[model samples]
Target: MPSKSSARLAALTVAAVCSAASTVVIASPAHADAVRIHDIQGSTRISPYAGQQVTDVAGIVTGVRTYGSSRGFWIQDPSADADPATSEGIFVFTGSTPKVAVGDSVTVSGTVSEYVPGGTSSGNQALTEITRPTITVVSSGNAVPAATVIDARSVPNAYAPAGDPAAKGSINGLTLRPTKYALDYYESLEGMNVQVANTRVVGATDPYTELWVTVKPRENASRHGGAVYGSYASQNTGRLQIQSLGKASDFPDANVGDVLTGTTTGPLDYTQFGGYTLVARELGTLEQGGLERETTRKQRRGELAVATYNVENLDPADGTFDEHAAAIVHNLQSPDILSLEEIQDNNGTKNDGTVGADQTMSKLIDAIVAAGGPRYDWRSVDPVDGEDGGQPGGNIRNVFLFNPQRVSFTDRPGGDATTATGVTKVRGKAALTVSPGRIDPTNAAWEDSRKPLVGEFVFRGRTVFVIANHFASKGGDQSLHAQYQPPTRSSETQRHLQATAVNTFVKQILDTQKNADVVTLGDINDFEFSDTVEILEGDGALWSAIKSLPRSERYSYVYQGNSQTLDQILISPSIRRGCDFEYDSVHINAEFHDQISDHDPQVLRFHP
Candidate 1:
């Protein structure tokens, strides 16, 4: 989440699928213990109970998301009556890995909590995360379907009873309304798969052009986790959800009734509806052949490297990345540590007039691979069903890519790209923790930036930290910086908070690790002379590539005829001794005003 400063600009995306039905009836039960999956639609209500010792559920896996290793998925609720998309629900685990597929029935056991609302936008309510009562699934399979749905009064601690008069207009089954204090919740369930039924499609609308599907729970819906793994709408006006969360461009010409199933790997949210909320995770369709081949591709050298790039809103206006793959790869060489900024995820158009982010990433990947780089493996940060943080994949964010030869990764915790963390930002950065031996030891202070990624790397005999940061632009609150304003809780002055966070973050890192070798690079959005840069440098002996060059030629990015050293490569002297890195200011847009990235390339040429 963008530190609190950028909350205002951060849009609200997901919401509770509520029905304008009757009030929910509250009741105290004999046992307020078992984690149950209940789906209440019209007069039908399905509830399933599970064992008290089970902690994770795995059935016909539905949504599968991966945050490094923390995974999440939806096991089919035997009590389901509607579509599996609506009936199967959510479960998360940092422990063992579960393998299943869509349409395949299974059961999982895990803790359950009620999902809180994130915010409201254009009449749609946003959810936080899937909330559930805890339980573990002992076993699962093509279980018998639910015969009937019990009243809300049948379940213990029913927030809204099945007959409560006040629970009529609920959001995602819960009576709660959307608010700003909501905490977006998500689970990490990668590699697992599942099958479901009773799904009905809701047509495209603002905030969501895909089909909004809802599934009824099975007869034993309450057996394990809650019902409703994920609810996805068709992406194309015709239907782009037939395949996994794979790229729309890579997908075959979508035919009606095509079964699209893939792995879930983003955030999922729950919204209040019928006294209960909806549970969901973002899913990516599994690739047919290329993905398997890429998965087995060898790495370049010894130590793994991670790189970040914006790819400059990578989307062809003429609709083709296949033709430009080679050229694009030449510009964005594969790196061990790949952090991509502004990558798209969904298949719909946003207010910004661009195709879906998912389409963009897919095309970029295909083009990159076709150009003959190490078959790089990639992953995206999915969104919570209820906490739909405005737009798909919780708003345009970065995805990480890695070469197995250099390094191997399991799971990485993902977050919204533009979450406003109170005093920090209006937009957030996607970050992850690395293994201890993966990097150098002197770079441990790299975890300070909320926008920063912390990962363990095994480099040369020791480990270190590597940070990728993109700071606030000269835009947003341009008037405030001119006025030299102080920080405030209001979203209006978020830029100040973003800047302050960077300043304090850098200081705290150095203060804590005096002998560390730190590297903070990316699109700072401001020139070397701006307050943003000075704030980042502080009283320390800060060093950047531009600092070593003549003032007139130090600029790395040129905007509107004005040259500015916005893209930088800053490092602590300790890590500079043996490193052979060069800041290649490609002047990307210098030749074409509309190049992919406004910023130039900053290359770090060190033997892995």
Candidate 2:
């Protein structure tokens, strides 16, 4: 099955293609004349002349996408029609290198067709294109068409169509309704020269040479900068993707909240990764955020500080080890106990049968000690060679790192990758049969996913039960920017089951010992508002500590302009009903472009 990102890209590709097809203007061969680019790209998404032959379609080549399967060039008419709904530009698909230059004025004759990316079964939109074209350069060095300004005011306040595609009219059947929906407004300007001025960075610069920006400040903007990714009801309408096609070096490294000044001019091109991207020729100046990385979290006496961090597939070969060590020591304040996720085997992405992360853990511990932190002791069950899923043979698993001077690991036997941990009553108190054990490792919910590692620790003579987890990722879910309102969360099913299993185990422990200091924390991979979190927090058995903070500060991760919580440290009710507990979502990463990990570590400091 395709991952959520892959599925979204497929869906967006289809939607863009289908939107282009809506502009076809059908005409008989006898009635065919020299067609302008705008006429070929009609007022609607699907072309009226789709699947028909056209002669002398004229425009100036503005941009060329030479890489990828969709190698093509974009053309825009200098003299455009006065219709706000009609685009003046169109993409010409040549399948290979095109015999055209950026400034060349060209005319071509070919059969108009609707091309669906990733095949028709993908249910994507069919892009209107002139395929197998015979081209003629009408002129050289003709001035390019002036770009139409598209500021926040020009974009609609709405995001998608009102109803289902069937109800709102099919992608190929609907008329252009640019005034009603942002999708329609973008569809109307598809393949057109456009410009956006004074934009604010909403997403950090990605590896794909793309970044998202908002032309206007969102109503629910984040106080720390960038737009707030709201619930299903609030779709960010002014956000747009900017892509550099001229010089890769010109693409700036920007974080969320950075500002781009001046005018960014380019032709708009719909893509699979992001919906509509401005293939920029002239870009704006990037003003740095001047955002400093966070310092060490404050530590207080008599409080046991426990933290959960997804190290993002950390291994010995990974170059971010030093930075990660610094973040843990300086930014996280060297918690007494740390639950680390995504600890790969000794050889990072090497798919060998090396399941032990001893070398990897040793290196990290060494780095931490060298970075002015205490020498830490670590313990984890080696996962079955190919059972736990992550990077192919990486054998990623959750491990515990503790300052031995401050805490002691209750080491016993019987813990392994495949065996489930058994609970026993010791002096009428809940206790793990094994010190470090896998919780229901063989359960189907954990198949092809990380199994939770439960460990017993003694901090200040008080035993604390810590279950480190890395739940099933949100791989198959629809993107927040999908055409569907309240997009489907297909990936939550497995996570829901996993959450239930963990919750049931926690309940068993609570049933035996009412005040068992339990901290189940790691990368849950679902938001605090999600059903997975709700399942884990069933009937008030567990409470997410992150919720104790202000709503504006609850996020541990940032994606596509939305500051959301994916990493959480949920405590049992016994731990929550105390007075000395304090939680913090330490801001060391996530929002910055130079992040060592995609997630920020969360810490819970309390007197247990």
Candidate with best TM-score: 2
* Model 1 quality (TM-score): 0.38
lDDT of 2 by residue, 93-172 (tens): 77687878889999978777666543443333455677768889988887888887887778888776643556332444
Per-residue lDDT value at 159 in model 1:
16
TM-score to true structure, per model: 0.38, 0.90
RMSD of 1: 21.6
Q: What are the C-alpha RMSDs, in order, of all predicted structures? A: 21.6, 4.0
lDDT (tens digit, per residue) of candidate 1 on 402-483: 5555555544332333331111111231222322111111122212212433343434533334545554444322111011
Top-lDDT structure, candidate number:
2
Whole-model lDDT for model 2 versus the true structure? Answer: 0.80
lDDT of 2 at 465: 95
Global local distance difference test of model 1: 0.35
